[model samples]
Target: MRILLVGAGLSGAVIGRTLAQAGHDCHVIDSRDHAGGNCHTERDAATGVMMHVYGPHIFHTDDAEVWDYVNRFADFLPFQNRVKTTSRGAVYSLPVNLLTINQFFRRTLRPDEARAFLECQADTSIADPQNFEEQALRFVGPDLYEAFFKGYTEKQWGCDPRNLPASILRRLPVRFNYDDNYFFHRFQGMPREGYTAMIRAILDHPGIATDLNTPYDPAMAGQYDHVFWSGPLDGFFGYRLGRLGYRTLDFERFDYDGDYQGCAVMNYGDREVPYTRITEHKHFSPWETHERSVCYREFSRAAGPDDIPYYPIRLVREKALLEDYVRLAQATPGVTFVGRLGTYRYLDMDVTIREALDTGRDFLARAAQGRSPAAFVHAPL
Candidate 1:
């Protein structure tokens, strides 16, 4: 069968590769001149450092199958995301670990003591938290929330923390131990040749054909037996319902002769700083050495029609509108919504790849049984 994949990012590439191996003709298309979407990485001309063109993308997951799958294409190098945050004129370790807690309070406390201390600081009155702010206050109290989360959350989302859902904060872990590692995933690493090269390798197959700078037109869908829409869900329908809220990022690039931040990512917890974080690209690829450095100051704002959407702002109003679009997608035929933008949710690199693999396998199974795949393999809501 002939398949059309819109947006040649991880989702489309993995799914297309899967179908191609199954004796299906898969055509992958991307509007951008390059593939890999946000995970696109290229070497800096001046510094010779492998810069994360969009932003820093650390591949971390507990899924062994997903880890092995990525490793099959690129050499997986050991990489743990150790994040730092500057707040109120002081730098602190992220994830609000024991070291951060002790440093902020100007006291050395054991793990058990710190845990008890944190409980005391929390506002236990609010038993059931509704929003990000409340959840922060309930877990870490006002001081930690103001210093560590409040300003950063507001800057990242471009809204008050209360305006966001509680699930956002619930997903973030607060550590009582001194582990400064950002993620708890068992397998974490960066690709040796960069994400773009890895993606290229994924698309390098006889049954797979790729076209860069190729935008997906509605008419193109009619030419294929099936379509995988990895682009924005509302975009597929031309925003007929309404534009779902999304936050876009702007990266301000600058080059330095020496190491910039000494770390891959340094987030600014102060809203007054304008930009949320500063990323030193060289640190992302630690094995390589370069005297010259490249860095970016990342700024997040409400997405415009022309801007590249980053985070999905799934507030109450957006959820209602999303429901309307989901209904429309369900009624539509011969197209399946896949990945972050397609499903309209914030997805990690691992989750996106895992879903794409599952979606592809499901499609193959259904096709074998003389059936068409569903509009969504996984529920967006």
Candidate 2:
């Protein structure tokens, strides 16, 4: 079977490699000049520092299979995400941990004491929180919400916290302990060489062929036995119904002679601060040292038609629109929508790979049974 895999990102690479190994001829294509999509990493010509081309991507997951899958391709060095946030003219550890609670209040409280204090601070009146603001106020309390979440939420989402869903606040967990590690995933690390190098290794299969800088043509679909569309869901249909809401990022790139923020990522929790976070790429690879560093100040906004979509704005309007697109995709034949953009959800690197692997196996099994492959391996909604 000659399978067409769209977008040479992780989804395409992993899925293509899987199918290829199963004796299916796979051809991968991407609009970008290089593979790996947003996870693309390249070396700085000046400093020889590895720069995360789009933005910083930290690989972390609890799934051992996903962890082992990536490690098989590249050497992953142990790296933990220690995120710091600048708020109220002071630097504080993120996740609103005991250290942060103590530092903000100017008191050295123990873990249990801090938890009790936060519970008292939290608004117990709101039995069921509906939006991001209410969720924050109920969990972290008013003071911490205003200091750490409110301003940052407004800037990042480009709207009032009340407008956003409560699920958004769930990702930013508040800790009772002093542990400041952003993610509590069992496996956490970065590819030693770079994500691009790792992806290239993944694509290095005899049955797979990758074509970068090549956009998908509607005519090409008829030529393949099956198509795995990893591009935007609405995009596949030419957005005839409507465009799905997505928040794109604008990065202000800067360089420094030595270390700048002394960390990989620094979040600006002040509304006055134009950008959301500052990512020091050098800090991403702590295993290698470089005198010079590269950084990006990320500013999030509504993604225009020409812009590259990052975070999906799955608000009321977009959800309705996405439903229409899903119906159309389900009605279509010989195509499977897979991965983040295709499924219209923000997925971590590990989740993306896990789904891709799952999708490939499912497709093969379906083909063997002489049955049609699913339009979606996972529901978009």
Candidate 3:
């Protein structure tokens, strides 16, 4: 079998490696000059610091298999994400932990009291919350929602929360305890070398041939027995169903001698602030020390034609557009759409890798039995 992978990101690399290992000839192509897609990382030319090209992607996952698989490619240093947000002229711990609650409200509320207080602030009338705003209001209430989520989310999605779907907020963790570890996963770390090194190792299989800055087209699609597309779903059909909505980021870099924000990530939770968050790249790798630090002010906006799509909007209209693309995907034989853009969803790095692995396994299973792989591992919602 000849397999053609449409993108050289985690999904494409993993899928290609899996098929190639099974004696299939795999050809991987990516539009970017690099292999790791948005997760691509490289050492800063002058500083020798590992720079996360797209942004800081901390690999955090509870799945033992996923963690072990990733570790096989590159050494991973144990790192937990501790995030903070500045709102209403004050800085507070994030993920709505007990300490953040107590400190933000200026009251030492117990676990139960804090939970109850949050409920008191919620809008009880919204039984079935539809949009992001309503969902936040129902879950955390007006004060906390406005303080932490409203402005940041608006900037992130490039729209009022009312325009976005409720599912987006479901990823946010709300805890009553003082635990401030951003992710609840058991394994949390960044690659010791960098993500690009890990990806290069993953695609090191003998049967896989990589072509960066090459876009796969219909003429090229038929050259392979099967295709595992990790690019935008609409791009496969040439946007016959119209382009899906996405939120992309614009980073403004700054140099500092010492600590800038005192943390890796800091959300600017006021509407007045233009950027959503500021990331101190040096803090992401605390194992090494550098006198000069680098920070980026992350501005989120609606993805334009030439911009790289980041977060899937998945708004009502976008969902309708996505359904059309999914229908086309299902009808279009010999191709399986996987990963964030292919499935049209916002996914963490761990989840994307997990799903890609699952997709690879399913693809091989289907090929062995002479069947078509399912259009998706999980349903598009």
Tens digits of lDDT, candidate 1, 150-227: 999999998899988889997778899999999999999999989999999999999999999889888898799999
Candidate 3, lDDT over the whole model = 0.87
lDDT per residue for candidate 2 within 1-381, as digits (tens), equals: 999999999999999999999999999999999999999999999988999999999999999999999999999999999999999899999877889999999988888888888889999998999999999999889899999899998988899999999999998888888899999999999999999999999999999999988999999999999999999999999999989999999999999999999999999999999999999999999989899989999999999999999999999999999999999999999899999999999999999999999999999999899999999988988
Kindly report the root-mean-square deviation of model 3 from the true structure over all alpha carbons. Answer: 1.5
lDDT by residue (1-381, candidate 3, tens digit) is 888998999999888887888898999998889989999988776665678879889899888998999999999998999999999889999899899889878899999998899889889999999988899999998888889999888777777788877888888978999899999889999998888889999999999999988877789876888888888889888888699988888999888877777899998999899998999887889999887778889999889889999988777789899888888888888888988889998788888888888888898898789887788866676
Mark the regions of model 2 whose C-alpha exceeds 4 Å error after superposition: none
Q: List the residue pairs that clash in candidate 3.
A: none
Clashes of 3: 0
With a 3 Å backbone cut-off (N, CA, C), the pairs that clash in candidate 2 are: none
Query: Which 10-residue window in model 3 sums to the lowest lDDT?
Result: 44-53
lDDT of 2: 0.94
TM-scores of the candidates in the order shown: 0.99, 0.99, 0.96
Please report, in order, the local distance difference test score of every candidate based on alpha carbons.
Answer: 0.94, 0.94, 0.87
